[model samples]
Target chain A: MKGNFYLQGFLTFLKIGLFTIGGGYAMIPLIEREVVERRQWLSKEEFLDLMSLSQMLPGVFAVNFSIYIGHRLRGFRGSLALAAGIVVPSFVIILLIAMFFQAFAGNQVVEAIFKGIRPAVVALIAVPCIQLGRVAHITLATAFFPILVAVIIAIAGVSPVYVIIAVAVGAYCYGRFFKEG
Target chain B: MLFLELFCVFFKIGLFGFGGGYAMLSMIQAEVVTSNHWLTSSQFADIVAISQSTPGPIGINSATYSGYISVVNEGYPAIVGILGSLIATVAVVLPSFLLVLLVLKILNHYREHPLTKTIFAALRPTVVGLLLAAVIVLMTKDNFGSVTDTPWQFCVSVFLFLAAFVGTFFYKVHPIRMIILCGLAGFLLYS
Candidate 1:
């Protein structure tokens, strides 16, 4: 019975993984409907707590969210099953593309299709940046940091690793001395 | 040997990546494209499109694809490319897996800690910058063809780009729809 429950959980995660096109916040409503409403596995509060906790951690948000939910339901076994379910589809699909796409590397029609998608993809990335800025509550005073970062990295070609380290230390110190958290 | 390198690189990506997949794009570009030369800019953009249209996070999708492409591009067999994908996917997942587990014990306390609050608050704007940089870095001739070489295609790219921006940002057109429409437009026009 316990094993079957976790197996079902795995399937649920698999569904989540398979259908969650575009990932990130798009996943929130799906998890809400499936885990909170249909399955009644998590309370609204528990789900919110998990989402925030996942944000504080690193790696994939989808995986982090799954980790919280899985471990809650069945500890380590639940975590493994859900994560595996979530990742397998993406892994398989990309691998298939990798294996097959090169064969069409010279195809004109495929090249044309990709040519159209390419510029659109850049816009897709830009929209999120603007959206994330709003979410971060980026104001004029704080806006300078992000602008400088983009300029240096984009125009001047500085590595992001250095910017990350510098910003972290600088922000921590700014919080300690200039303002409170 | 390249497997080992892929593992190391993705592990570092996992360890440093924050603010989710989009934010991680900066780190991915820094390592996979700029540093390692595993995939070119256009290839990386294609992977981004695939990742978005597919299920799962950009981190995992890019890792898996980059792993396979890197190996295959290196003259490895397709079977070995599978192994490369596995190694990269595992590496990217490993840090966060261990991190979630490690923090599980002190989860409640850690979430409410003042230190965490300060750090997260500080990091929020930084992630915005990272995402911005990801877009800026990706805006290149590689993704949008150079005007000198193909003015018609280049003009079409700029038009499609603006249209997609308005469609996505202002009108909130579904990303999948935008992608498909752009693809169809490409097929109809270019093909």
Candidate 2:
């Protein structure tokens, strides 16, 4: 593989990694711009498919999505390059912050700011609930599963990993045997 | 030894961390704070708050931040603590990287397979459920004060939560902006 394509891939993701705030979901527009609009590396449809697949996979969404895009574009080497690009910014930035954490941790201003952001973060997480529900096509038939899973985790304090696996198995069985065409 | 433990714990976290960072918090807390006793619950809560406001993915930031704090607390040198952070970050990212490779190789062949479709179809709704569960998990007394313990603080926290939700969902305000506004609100009110 040509070195430049991998380098280009790396730089593209590096930009995304640095600029994206509020985590992976926020990177979508920037990613779309770089991959489709600017680079012309992927089509709109392909981007959408990759987006959904990224969400379904475990681990961070941006990294996972970049892996898919990079692999699809240029196989293993491209994937490696993009992975490094996407992660470098976060790694560097967080490492710096962690190093100074002890110094700034007890700052009254910082504490107060975190106090305000804490509840807002809760709200931030909740806003996505509505959007994701729409994407999942939540209907009466599918409604019970989310409610059941939520109850299991929230009330019973069950580990979510188990709930995820059980839901996948339950859905697979229903689709395979129970659901009619 | 601590390095190995950190890598193993985060690798497992990466493997099962469905529904992104918030969803993974309970598991991370269970392992590092509760299971290993690396950090206290209050400290873990602080890490979550910091991770949310900072750049990068929350999962990656949490892994990096927690890894450093875990080692530093263990009396390791600062350089070793940095190594711990790198290991945790890389380990947390590795599973998804490998999974993507396997997926790209296999999913192409079985893209149309009924079993695959069924599994994915079923997973969609449950993923949302898990995200919801993540929200509930974070709404602890750590993030939101208890009604009796801190009634006035609790009211303000609830107000911020509701405002963020309405602003983002209805008005389509960017989350980054909301975070900044909340920070100002915090400084204004608390400081």
Candidate 3:
């Protein structure tokens, strides 16, 4: 039974590592479904805790979440096992692709794949945008701020680093200079 | 000297990289293109496009590719290119590994604190901003000919953009399917 738990944890991470395309947020619902709903490895509350912990720490949220969940289920060994599970497949695949990238570098089929993937990547990123907005109870004012940031970065030719800094500064100024709180 | 610099830059990026691969873009651009002068802006943008199209995180892919290019251009031995790539890759990932370990140690103590909750709330909106920035940059980049010159391409991009938006938002279709459909569309129309 204990061995079964270890195997389940390994397989869960392996699936996440192998299939997830965009990383992090893209894997959230799938992870939630597998660990919380299907496998019953964690309760909903525990999953939320994991989410919070994953966000608070550095690194990819999905990777951090794996560590947290693995640790919760077992211990240090479990965390290592899960982390390996989440990283190994992508690592191996990326290394292999990088080594042979020149062969298919200009293939028409490859170009087609990328062209298709780009828009989908946009949609993948958008999912969390809409979901997070809903969770945050986005008002017109709050909604406008992020949209404005998006437009500035997308259309106005600003570097994202500066944009992030500007937004941080703007938020600080708004909170400090404008808001009563 | 160059290899050491590469290691340090990627290490910082990996350590502070919040959100994910996209968040690392700004730091990478700043460190590699702006500060180090290791690669030109056009090259950096190309690396980004290639990394996005290929599998794996943008941060790691760019590091490997950049390290390879930088070492080769410098007339270093081929082994140096491999060493540079390894150093950058390991450096970029090291922070996340350590952070996970540290979080494991302290998480039990501060798991339910109000301060922690407030920080998470604050971070959520900021993450949204970061993602928005990525989308904006990709759309507005000048590498693709101007919207005026490639009206068809622009139109196609917009069409796919909306199709994906509606498909995911309303129909709840999986994103992977959307990607596959877009690939098919590109093959039929552009190829």
For model 2 chain A, the run of ten residues with the poorest summed lDDT: A172-181
Off by over 4 Å in 2: A40-52, A139-144, A179-181, B20-53, B73-77
Query: How many steric overlaps does candidate 1 have?
Result: 0
Model 3 CAPRI quality: acceptable
lDDT of 2 at B90: 94
Candidates' C-alpha lDDT: 0.84, 0.82, 0.66
Which candidate model has the greater DockQ, 1 or 2? Answer: 1
The lowest-lDDT stretch of 10 consecutive residues in candidate 3 chain A is A94-103
Question: Best to worst by DockQ, what's the order?
Answer: 1, 2, 3
> For residues B1-191, what per-residue lDDT tens digits would candidate 1 score against the true structure?
89899999899888778788888877888788877888889888888888888877788898898998889888988899899999999999888778867866786676676665777777778888887888888888888878899888889999999999999999999988999999999999999
Give the alpha carbon lDDT tens digit for every residue of A74-120 in model 1.
Answer: 88788888888788887888788877887787689988998899899
| Top-DockQ candidate index | 1
Residues forming the 10-long window of minimal summed lDDT in candidate 1 chain B: B107-116
lDDT of 3 by residue, B68-141 (tens): 65665567865676777777777876676677666556766865655445545555566566566555445533
Q: Compared to the true structure, candidate 1 yields what TM-score?
A: 0.94
| TM-score of every model versus the real structure | 0.94, 0.86, 0.69
